[model samples]
Target: MDTEAVNNARHGLRLLLVTLLLTSIGFFIYYVYRQALPKPLPGIPCDEVAAKKVLGSLPSMFSHWKQHGVVMPWLTGHNLKHNPPLVQFFGAPFAQPTVILSDFQESQDILLRRGKECDRADRTLQSFEGMIPHHHLAMRTNGPRFKGNKELVRYLMSPKFLHEASAVQIYEKSLALIDLWSLKVKTSGGKPFPARQDIFDAALDMVSGAAFGFKDDLSITKRQLNHFLSNGVKFKEHENGSVDFHGFLFFGYIVAGHETTSSSLSWALKFIADHQTEQDKLRQALWEAFPDAAAEKRVPNVKITTTHVPYLDGIIDECMRLETSQTKITVGSWSVDDMHLFKPERWLKTGDSGELVYDS
Candidate 1:
C-alpha cells in the first residue's frame, strides 16, 4: 500500500474510536439524568411540576421553609392544592416519594389498625437511629428491640403510676412556673413580654423532674425565679430577643416530650390571651370547681385539679386541636367545619344528666 493511504486509514480509525467514546458518554449522562428524576408511586397523586424536576418537591419545600421557618404548613397546603385524600412528594433527590395521607380517619386506620400493612417509614427510623441508636423509636414494630423496649416502659403509661409518681413533681414545677410568670408580670408592668423561653424552660423542668426525679432546687423555672428575685432585675420589653442558656445536654427525652409539651402550652397561652371571653369562662369554671381553694387563695392540688373541670378540659382539648405541635394533617371529615377557629365550646356538650360535659 502507498504511505499516504496507510496514514489516511490510521486517521479514520482514530476518528471512529473518538466518535464511539463520545456517544457512550452522552448515553451514560442521559441515563443518570433519567434515574435522578422523580418517580411517583402507582395511582398516587403528586404535584405535576414536581414530578418533572430532578429535586422533585424539595426546591419548593425549601423555598416555603425559608419564608415560614417551618415545612408542615407547606406540606399540608398541598391538600388544598390537590384536593385529595392522599398526596405524594419527593423529599430528596433519588429517594422514594413520601405519600401523605390527609384524611384523618384513614391516617388513624393506617397508624393504629393497619400496622401489619403500614409500619414506620425508613426516614423516621433513620432520623431517630442517628440520635438514639438503641431507642425503641428507632426500631420497627416487628423488631425484638422494639418489643423489649416497649415492655420496659409499659408501666409508665398507667394511671396509678402517673397520679402517684409524676403528678407531685409536675405540680411543684407548675408552682415554679407561676412564680416566674408573676415576677415577669410585675417587671413588665402590663406590657407584653416574650413567654416562649419561659414556657420551654418550665416544660423542661417538669419533664426532667418527672422523668429523672430532679429536685426543686435543680428546676429550671425555680432557678430563673430565684435569679430574678435575688437580683431584682427588671425585664426589658422587646419584640424579639435572645436569652442566655445554662448549659445542658440535649437528649431524646427533649425530642419525645419537652418540645411537644412546650409548643402546645405556648399555643394554649397565646389562644387564651387572644380570646378574653374564653379565658374568663375558663377562670370562672376553675374557681367554681375548686371553691375551697379559691376562697383560701391557693391553687388546687393534682387530685382536685384532675377531677373533671369541664371548661378547662375543653380549653386544653381545643388548644391541642387548633395548634398541634406535630405535623398538621387535614382534620377528619366529621370535624372539618371551622377547624381553624379557636372555639373551646366545640369540645363542650350537654351530658346525659343535662350538665355541661367535656367531649373529646
Candidate 2:
C-alpha cells in the first residue's frame, strides 16, 4: 500500500481508540452513580403506619420479641426458623459495614467481643457535640482533660453516690406522687384518674435529682440542656450540615439514662397492674418489709433496700426486660469533611454472597 493509505489507516485506528475510551469513561460514571444512589429498598418503604404502631405499642412489641427471642413475623415479616435476623439489614445501605447480629451468640460477640471495631462518630454526634460541648466525656475517654474528668466522674458518681442519690430522689418523688394522687382522688371523690402525668413528674424529678443534684424546675439549666439537645447545634441551616459531637452525646445520655429509667419504672407499674395478684403480693411484701412505715403518713420514711426485697428487684428486672429499651442503641456514620459529603450516594447493601457490606 502507499504511504498515504497507511497514514489514513493509522488515523482511523486513533479515532476508534478515542471512541472506545470515551465509552468506557461514560459507563464508569454511570456505574458509580448507580452504586452511590439510595435506591428504594425492595419491599420496605419506611412503612410509616407500621412505625407508628410500633412506637405506640413499643412495650408490648418488645416484650413479644424478647419472649420469642426473635423479631415477630407480623411486625418484621421474618421468623427465627427460616428468615434469620441477620438479613433484616441486607437490603439497606449505611456508612459502615455493619454486622446485623440477630443470634444471641453473634449479638454478644459484636456488641461485647468486638464493639471497638464499630466507631461512633456520625452525623448525630455532630449535632450532639454542638448542643453540648461537655457530652464528649461520656463517649471518648481520650485526651488528658477527658481522662481526668472521667476519673473524677467515676469517683463522684460511684455506686455509693448513685445509691444515696437514688434512694433520696426516689423517696422524695414517691412522697410527692402519693400526695398528688391522694389530693386528686379526694378532689375526684375517689373516681379513677389518669396517673401517667403524676408518674412522669416523679420520674422527671428523680432523674433531675440524680443528674443535676436538684429536681427539674425547667430552669436555665434544664432548658439550656434540653433545648440545645432538641434543636441540636445548628452548624448549618441547609438540608445537610455538620453538627457538634458533644450535642450528640447529650442526646445519647438523655435517652440512655433519663428516658430508659422512666420507661422501666412505668413498665414496672404497668406489669404489676396487669397482674393484680402479683401487685397484691408486692404490696404485702412492702408492708412486711416496712411494718413501721406501712401507714400512709409514714410511707415517706420507707426506704428501698436491696437486702430487704429480693422479689421487688426481680420484678424491676423483669420490667426492664419487658421494656426492651436495651436494643435501641445504634451507631451511625457520615463523612466529616465537605469534599466527602458532596457525593450523595454510598449506602449499605448486601454483597453478591448475600452478606451485608458498607460502601461509604
Candidate 3:
C-alpha cells in the first residue's frame, strides 16, 4: 500500500510541473509575436509585406540603402507605392510606425497651423538633447528654454545683423576660397581637382567668423591656402583621377550649419559645371549686375552681390530645390514636366517693367 501511493503521488506532481512550464512558454511566445506585429496608425497606408515580418520596413530600407548609399529615395518611394498621401512604416522592432506625409501643401498647413496640436517628436528632441543639451532645437516649442534660445539668436537672423555683421565675414571667407581655387588651378595645371574639402573649410570659416567673431587669419581656408602658397605644394592625384589635399575636422550647431552649407555648395558647383550654358548665362548676369567690378577684373563686394541679381538667385534656389540637404517630410507637386532638370530659368520670370526678375 505505501509503495503504490508514493509512486502515484510523484507521477501526479511531475505532470503538474510540466503543465505549468508549457503554459508559461505559450504565454511568452504569444507576447513576443504580439510585439513583433506591425501597429499601423489609423487611416495610414503601410507595406503589407513589411507588416508580416518582425523587422517591418527596416530590412527593405537597409537593402535599398546598401545598394544606393542612401535611404531617402527608398523612404520616399512609399509615396509612389501607395495612392494615399500619408504612409507609415516600422523603423524598428516593437517600435511605433513612423508616418510619412508626402503632400506638400497639407504638410505646410500642418506645420504652420497645427503647431500646438503637433509638438516636436520626443525621439527627435531626445536625440538632439543628447548632442546639444541647452540648444533650442532640443527643447519643445512651448518651453522656456526654446523661447530664451530664440530671443538670443533672433538678432542673428535680423536684416541689420545679417547684412552688416554676417555678410562682411562671409564675403571675406569667400575671397579666401577664390584664392585657394586659383592656387589649385595653377598647381594642377588646369586639371580637375576635388573641391569638397575646400568648400567645407570655406563654409566653416564663414560660419565661425560670422557667429563667433573669428578673424580672417584664423580661418581654415586661409590657413590651408597660405600653407599651399608658401610651401609650393602640389595636389596629389589618386589612381582614380581625383586629387587630394590635407584637411582637418572639428565638432555642434556650427558643424551642422557647415555641413549643410558645404553640401549645397558642392551640389551647386557640380550642377554649374555640368550645365555650361547656364553657367555662361549666370556669369553674364553677374557681370551685368556688377559692371564696375567686372570692368576692374575683381570680385564684387558682399553688398553688391547681395543685391537683386536675378540669375544668381535663380541658380541658388534651383540648386537647393534639386538637392535638399535636410530630409524633409513633404514632397513637391509632380505636375511640372521639367522638375528633374537643373534649369535655373525655372525660377525666373519677366517683371511688370519687362525686366528679368527672380520668381520662385
lDDT of 3 by residue, 1-360 (tens): 999999999999999989999999999999998888888887788998998888999999999999999898987787789968889998888889998887555666787678788888888887777656676767789987778775766666678877887789889998988998988898888998889878887887787777677786678887787778777965432221222211111124464567787888898998899999999999999899989999999888887636889999889877766764533333334346877788887778999999999876
Report how far residue 309 has shifted in candidate 2, in Å.
Answer: 1.0
Q: What's the TM-score of each model vs. the native?
A: 0.81, 0.53, 0.78
Query: By the lDDT metric, which is better: model 2 or model 3?
Result: 3
- Cα lDDT tens digits, model 2, 1-360, are 699999999999999999999999999987765554333234433333322331323454466678886554434443332255553222222232222344443454565556467534454456555555555423443334565544534633466866677667667666666655565566567888666544654676666566556654432233333443465442111121232323333344444466556666776777777877767766776687677667653662624644345445445544543453444323234344632221212234457997434443
Full-model lDDT, candidate 1: 0.78
Candidate 3 clash pair list = none
Higher-lDDT candidate among 1 and 2? Answer: 1
Q: Give the per-residue lDDT digits (tens) of candidate 1, residues 270-341.
A: 999899999999999989998998999998988863688888888887776667354433333346677777
Candidate 2 has an lDDT of: 0.50
Q: Which stretches of candidate 2 lie over 4 Å from their true place?
A: 1-29, 37-83, 90-114, 117-127, 133-149, 181-201, 215-256, 295-297, 300-302, 327-360
All-Cα superposition RMSD per candidate: 4.7, 17.2, 5.8
Tell me the TM-score of model 1: 0.81
